[model samples]
Target chain A: MEWIIIPDKKPDTHVEHIYREKTDKRILKRNPWRDVRLHGTVLVLVIIAELIGTIKIPITKDVAITIMPLIYTIILGLAFYLIKPIKWIHRKQARIAEGAMMLFIGVLIAKLAISSGQSIGLIFEMGPALILQEIGHLATILVLPIALLLGFKKEAIGMTNSIGREPNVAVVVDKYGFNSPESRGVFAIFIIGTVIGTIFISFLVTFSLSFLPLHPYAFAMASGVGSASMNAAAIGPTLAAFPGMETQIEAFAGFSNLLSFCVGIYIVIFIALPLTERVYDWLEPKIGRDSIMPEKEDDNNA
Target chain B: MPDLIDSSENVSVHGIFNWILLLFIFSVITAVGNFLGYHHPIEGSLIGMAILSFITLIGVWLERYVPLDISSILYISVIGIIVAFPGMPTSEFVLKYVSQIELLAIVTVFLAYVGIGMGKSWDEFKALGWRAIVITVLVIAATYYGAAIVAHIVLVLTGVPAV
Candidate 1:
């Protein structure tokens, strides 16, 4: 929490000052890339080891069932460790790392669960299944504050310091004057247009897909493409409710997420960018450029 | 100096109390959802967020009568947990599905960053004229269609079962 404020300072320290500071005998220098590479390599080795160990051990159905949760817990723990620093450093990078970590964790857990003799269907039915069916849910209310306190402390001191700053565009937008009726009308139109366009596109995709002999996986993928969090949450209940389609649904959800990841960046840049620009342009002419940057005029006159 | 000290003390107390309240609210929502058999983790989270947001709004409204500072610390913590949890499936699902979600999250964050970076001031955008507006609309349309097409092809080729 405190680290959030570090970037607000106007550092008088130059590059030379930074270099000199780095050279100080008391200051321990580190290569972040090197650290990342080492961690990556270690993670790879651990994954390989786990895979080989699982395959080599002739796990009985009962044993595999018990080991499944334990393995998942371990992997989850490892994922937390691997992602903690990255999450702190860069949220985007943290996501990538977390994804990889999740994959490994999922595999280890799945393998353990399957080997332990419990049907994947049963686990789905009893655990997350039951949890999902309950609509009016809250996390265990008592433990919430402790968890939040720990998170704040961790974020403040950990990677929060290194995360990049917000872009300047937001500030300018906030400052821009768009009080005129015409400008307001244009702005409203733009929002409505974007929403309508998005909805139309979504509908089209759904309609076209209706013709195919697509798997439930495809549906899940569609859901993911439509919205990641929504799809992710739906998977448990969807799987549990329709037990026969669990594996395929799970697979589709995974693939859909991957596809969305691949496309989301390009879509935002290529699609959202222009739309935002156009809306601004339409409003600007009506509002007048001078009104938008009154501060700039003042500075110029001064 | 004395006034500043007094204000800072007040702010800290306000922050602490707010966090405690948030914790209570989040726990109650999640617990009730669990008890009621709302298995959709995402829905549970949404409920939690909605409740929190409502609470914050109400608190802000009440601030006219009483000086109170909402603690962002509590909000962030709850969000982090919500994001991190629900991926707690039988390890296989987590392994397969979680990574994909992670990748999606990364892409989303990256896109958001790009959007923020490319964002124009209201004045600048206004000055750019109708051509800019047209371009943005086209781009949004094209991207959505393009992604949809790609998804369709992938799904078809993979022989995914129809809903």
Candidate 2:
């Protein structure tokens, strides 16, 4: 093998220019508050919403728990849609915005863990029942036929993760390169869900807890689909639904979520993804499209 | 300090100080919000949030060592719970407030950020088209109901009281 020993010299001007062009300003500026106004607006809204929720209001507890998040979520989404036309969210802001949710996840989980610590015995006692709730994750298979029906191609396999947690996403992204259409498909759902999943989960879980024959504990365990934010989202309202079992429910949910995170990847790789493939092939001619995205349009997008 | 924090603009971010400051302030401010929202003992919750913030900082640092996806929250959850109370009350404070503070308020802020982030990717989403919407809705439905189904069967099998 021939090794070339090159001089340790600075890049030429053209090379530097080419390199600079590829780099985003966010890499250079690193302004924490470049997007502060927009970020601040959201933060302020949350605080106000928090106050509104805690203080007495005319709305009944049932309506408030079920619909409050949904209302704020829609308004916020509309605001986001409106600002997009004006280029309000630039690359740096986009980075912060994307990361903002996970930032608070620890705090919420920390609280849940504290409750879990108190109810550790409860977790052990409810072992098999708690473990069985993970079977709900098997429902990701439902997306198979739906994605195909909606004209998804092979990439629809990426959409099988119902939890939208980082681990499940990692499983898919690792299998299919980040630039693959499959990754893009999963990423889009992940983003959309992160933006709105909490509200939807809160509403749906509470409603399900009301009429479903299953105990609130079942939904609590179900909440632990590997994502802290989603767990918090699902568990918060369930706590309200079963005010007395708040700590026990969170304990079960937190531990179950941890279990899910540990086992989620294997299930996705060995079971879920392959199952989706068979279903994809079986239904392709009847429902699948050529591709989710037009050819190479986002080839450069990561 | 600002210059130091934002000094590097590359593939990897190198702003430990800024992150530390931001995270500390975030915990404190959110703690205050929770206090106002839940009417929990302000002092206890504040100290708890501070300790948890510090623990979270440790988790952040620890992430560099642990290559896996799990970090921050759960890692801190276990440590915080074990070390807290009778010793520091960090865990108890959090446990007290966690139930009462309206979680939607906390969630909406993050969701709003995600919405703004999605704003930047409107084209990508547009390219994804209606199928993205259909796929997301259907997947969520399947996930929720599927879990409920499993829960139903489990309750029956274990002979646990349903609801």
Candidate 3:
């Protein structure tokens, strides 16, 4: 079965219906081709960001080359709110772009993989250390029992995996079905992480490299955890850290990222998902179930 | 083409043709992006994009051969490494330009797209409730610190010289 990343469009949130309803209110009411226009508007915005991103500006010692993209994202996003013409069309397209996430994921992984072939030697040298570090990615499961202890709702277990990468989302959707109790948690974190995960990872990696005694190689490896853009963002500062060896650092990092992307799914499915269920069971018995479950999604309240 | 194409999925000729068209578009944009960046020359980015496109296609083809969901990164990277290893026809090209293109430039577009997508979904997110907020906090903290702690230990154990 093809693993779909597009959220099952709820009746209230159907993009086509939303588009049609909005169209009736506008003067372009008769235009059946408005969807194409909406896509074009967002595509133009993306091109603007792309053009601006190529220009490099030095912002302190380690933070150069990335400022433009960040600035563009903020400016364009703000413009969407301030400029009504673009904002309305932008709204229709956001869901379209979001649904096409699988395309971006494939492109990202393929783009990053070009460097993977070159990183094999570095990966072999790093050996178990890299593997062990990646295993630590599973430490995300540590939050399961803790979330339960804090009396999080049952569905909130989905956010236990940060950045809800494709694999994490797949596992949850597969196990729980579309609107399963945990689906809301997964979708919620997925949205937040997708919005913020890349920049967040970039800053965290950069800060850790500067302040901590970490081998830049390790941070390089950590950068490759599933999401291609997030991996690229995180790998940026590590490349900055290694400076002259940017190529070599990327090779190792690229290979590590490939492992995370390729293997991270199985680990989540076979290990983390099951371990989470076990932890939830263990926690409920230890702390009253009502105490652990975060407030459940009550649509009636809405 | 049997191995090359996934029959399990209901793939039509139109689908394959569409993908081919997308590959062309991706290549053109990447090349054009490079030309725009430098102003004077388009040779490097074009050459880089061409190779990248071919390598990426191979990645798509090789996807079926791998065990589990190996996807594009592994197949392309591994094949790229094998062909470009030490001294090969593609080594010089791969070595010079694989990491040369400004990845930031390309990904920035996706970032902006992602932001709008997130904004559009705010109502549904609000529906997830306050616990969603707390859960997000824990998820981010644990993912970062958990990886940090492990990386720290591994570096210490391996005696990797700290920068």
Top-scoring candidate (DockQ): 2
My TM-score estimates for the predictions, one after another, are: 0.28, 0.77, 0.76
Candidate 2, B67-117: lDDT as tens digits = 664555557776756753434545455555444443443445445555555
Expressed as tens digits, the lDDT of each residue in A17-122 for candidate 2 is 1122122233224445445665565656566655666321325554433545424543564465556464554654655554544455555566566666777766
RMSD of each: 22.6, 7.3, 7.2
Given the true complex, what DockQ would model 1 score? Answer: 0.03
DockQ of each: 0.03, 0.40, 0.28
Per-residue CA lDDT of candidate 3, range B1-163, in tens? 1222222332234433443444444445444544554342456655665566676656654554454655555666677667657666767767676555655444554455455555665566556555555666557656655655676688778787765
Candidate 2: the clashing residue pairs are A27-B9, A28-B9, B85-B89
lDDT tens digits, residue span A190-291, model 1: 332222222333333333333443344334444433232223333333343335654445544444333333343333334433444444445434433232
lDDT of each: 0.29, 0.59, 0.57
CA error at residue A175 for candidate 2, angstroms: 1.9
> What order do you get sorting by lDDT, best first?
2, 3, 1
Candidate 2 Cα deviation (angstroms), residue B52: 2.0
Residue A65, candidate 3: alpha-carbon lDDT? 40
- What's candidate 2's DockQ score? 0.40
**Candidate 2 C-alpha RMSD relative to the actual structure:** 7.3
Clashes of 3: 5
